[model samples]
Target: MSAAARETPRWLAPAPLWTARTVAAASEEFLRPWIAELRTDSFLADFLSIVGGTDGRSPADLPATLPERSDEDGSYRLFPSHSRRYYLVLASLVCHRPGIPDHTVQPALGERALFVLRRIRQGAEKGFVPSATDTGTWQPATAHALVPGERELPLHRAPVAAFAAPGTAAATLGMAAGQPSARTVRYGYIPVSGGDTVADDVTTTYVIRAVLVRDPCAPVISAPTQPFELAGPLDPDAPRRPSAATTKGPTS
Candidate 1:
């Protein structure tokens, strides 16, 4: 056996019969620092644009941009383009897994996935609601409260038809909820070389956390169950609020 493999505990070695799960104790440990360093509209715009491109959309069609300030309720209002929402959902889903070497899907990231998943679910539910104006543009809004029930969907059972080719085995991903009974499915993709020996294999997994219900009548603001934290090139004590003297619009 290879030295590295021998060094690993027998239980820690990858097994054909086991699916390992990764969990983030706090999602904000990564999110807050990233958000705090976004001190300008240009940064926000560019970030959202990159996020949108991941979903196959032109950034020009995104919604009206917002200032780089978190609202009084501590939520950052990012007006990503209509097409960008899908990317945001996917990005949010994966962000908590910072240093994973490749995109190997696991059952779920546990509590770390909760923060981003909650935000994505809220955005998706809002997208389904009727528009308040006839302008045909969807309103970019945020809810302060956790929408009543969790919006959980089984990862493998949820229809990813929009993202995958017809009849492909994309459904074999992972469970959708955080409960102990959750099950995981793995779908592997292999690339064949001239000799047909497997050149590469990639797998993606998903887990449904919960199915959230919309509560339009609920209060718009509430205390966070957990506060956001900072990581990577950002100082936690740095002023989160932008300088008052800074003017709006692009600054050279």
Candidate 2:
């Protein structure tokens, strides 16, 4: 195995479990139906607020705010106060696809990562969440370390908080607020390597974070099996293994 392959972390198994095409197809199908069921503006607002850790409200407390439709495009988009970052992340993760160009997924992944970081920071500011360490305090060190020159991107404002967990650092971005009180978020990175000598062949280590929110009755969102079928075949030797995808239904 190559050096990069050897360094592959155990947490990033989900990214490679199914190919990018599979992820994208599953996302479009599974998520479109789920979002359509919401059908209310406040439903999305509360969902975004809860996910973003703004007021530390649960999905149950969300008012009846629905997304406005674009007269020109006829697509549903979140309200302005809603974080475009979180929406994109949820969309990407729930809809990942295999064999698609990295250029497409990269932007969504980066945006999601930044969204989590911002949420953690916001939680810290509101005293809803604590930084990574157990000292029960926030520190600059808890922030994510950007790859040198990549800091200039508007989405790069927040730093990623690393922890020993199952998902990528990006997944845990906004989960800090619910830590100890409502949820525990874990963050890490997955490095994909192989193929070419140039940067083109270098698969990025996607930063992913998973939020374990407190919901005894939360509905489980099923991971579609179609993605696996679409992606050629899973590498038997791949380090981290992918499991069925499940979402902790509306937080309440």
Candidate 3:
């Protein structure tokens, strides 16, 4: 069997994972600010120029006057979720494909080693029943770093308060802020699915991926991470590994 064939089918996974709406919402919450900054700093435009896309003209000049919401088409109506996809694609090229014919800039090791966390929900909830084919779509989620010793905190006592602001988190935790080799960091997500329905069995798990973020304000310049099912309680000190599973379900 080929590599693609070796991949697990989505339908075989456990039920009621992270809902699509929740994934979008969570990713947007964490990544939008950085994306907006990327647009403002002209990194996106500069990147486009470096790697010419379907239309082989430099759009490097377009971002200056374009609103934050404008995409490649120069349309003002792009939704946040849709815009993230566009940005992630740009990131994929920058991280994986590296440079084009004449560009000299390259992603640093620190930039290429950032983390993207996708939280998966399990157990039960009340809403429209989903068919086996309802596996969620593949999209990048919020990219962040874990503070030193954060994983040591117990699950219920997770240092969520420290994460109120990325900068504050760094300051309070006494580590180098941003993507630096000196700081040992990781990120996790809290499930938002328990809001509407009450289920005794509801549980949440995080699906994390290794990705490159050229800057805090940039989208992930890498391909989407594959999803995988991790059984049992999360072990904070366990080694990190990549997986390929993104399960979708009803939002509420």
User: Top model by TM-score, which number?
Assistant: 2
lDDT values of the candidates? 0.22, 0.24, 0.25
Report the number of clashing residue pairs per model. 15, 36, 14
Model 1 local distance difference test score: 0.22
Model 2 lDDT tens row, 35-150 = 21132235445444543445555422222222233333333322221222112222222222332212111332222322221112222311113435553422332222322222
lDDT of 1 by residue, 1-252 (tens): 332322110000001111112122222221221111223435434434432333453212222222233334333333232212101211112211322211222223211112212222222422122334642322323444343333322211111111222222211122112212122211111111112122344211111122112222222121121121111132323443443222121110
Model 2 Cα shift for residue 11 (angstroms): 14
Q: In angstroms, what RMSD does candidate 2 have relative to the true structure?
A: 20.6
The true-versus-predicted C-alpha distance at residue 79 of model 1, in Å, is 6.0
Return the TM-score for candidate 2, rounded to 2 decimals. Answer: 0.22
